[model samples]
Target: MFLLYITALIIVIFLLETVVIDLFIVRGVKPDFILIITVYSGLFLNKTTAETIGFAFGLIQDALSFKQMGINSLSKFLIGYSIGSLRENILSENVIVQCLFTFIASCMNGIIYILILKGLFYSEIEVLDFFKDLLIQSLYNTFLAPIIFFMLNKVHFNNVREFRGRKEEARTD
Candidate 1:
């Protein structure tokens, strides 16, 4: 049941980010819902679940995009795993923490993609354009992170164990 809910949510977000979000783009900037979900899941979910969702959604995103394949999956999967690993160290209910995570994740995502493009595909790249887009996208995502987290908080994910950001004998499941 949890998987079904998450899958459906990701599908809806994927559609929104790909199609509907085009209308809201401001200066070639838009929020990355996939990245937000990846981070949110990492904070509130189990390690394996967070990484699984991140990689799967990234793959779906890659399959549909025109850019080099595997880039999204690799970056997002790493972000998910890294964030999940830090749950214990960064336990908090603060919005700033979420924004910080979003900012870092967004930057990391862009940097990884650019590296892959340059190293693997050997694509011609404009340095200024890359930094501009990366900054805008990271800011856009960072600003929206809190709102997304708040909304997702309203949705009860009953079937998964939510790590309390620390080790405890009590089980969430």
Candidate 2:
């Protein structure tokens, strides 16, 4: 049931990102909804689950966009794994922490993608322009993270263990 929900949600986000999000673009930059979803999965789901979703959705996005295959997949896979690993040490419930994680993940994804593109294809993308776009996209993703987090929280997944169990345990002391 949880897997079904996540798969459906990813499809919906992918559709929205490819077909709808461009309408709301600002300064020629649009929020990456799929990226946000990957971050959310990393923060809330198990590492393996999150990385799997990242790779799958990244492939879907690549297919839809006609870009170099596997670039987005590799970037998102790393982002999901890296951020998901931090779940053991950080307070995932904090909005500020969520925002920061999204920002950092977005920046890392951009850097990794650019590096791969440059290294593999020798694409002559201007460094400053890429940085400018990266900054804008990071800020845009950060702004959307809180809202995405709130919405995701409402959709309970049985596979994920609630942190409330720890609080309940402490209360008995």
In terms of TM-score, the best-performing candidate is 2
Q: Write candidate 2's Cα lDDT for 50-129 as tens digits.
A: 89988888887777765679988888889889988887677787899999999998999899888988998899999899
Q: Estimate each model's TM-score.
A: 0.88, 0.89
Q: Report clash pairs, candidate 1.
A: none
Give the Cα lDDT of each candidate: 0.82, 0.83
Model 1, TM vs. native: 0.88
Taking all chains together, the TM-score of candidate 2 against the true structure is 0.89
In model 2, the worst 10-residue window by lDDT is 156-165
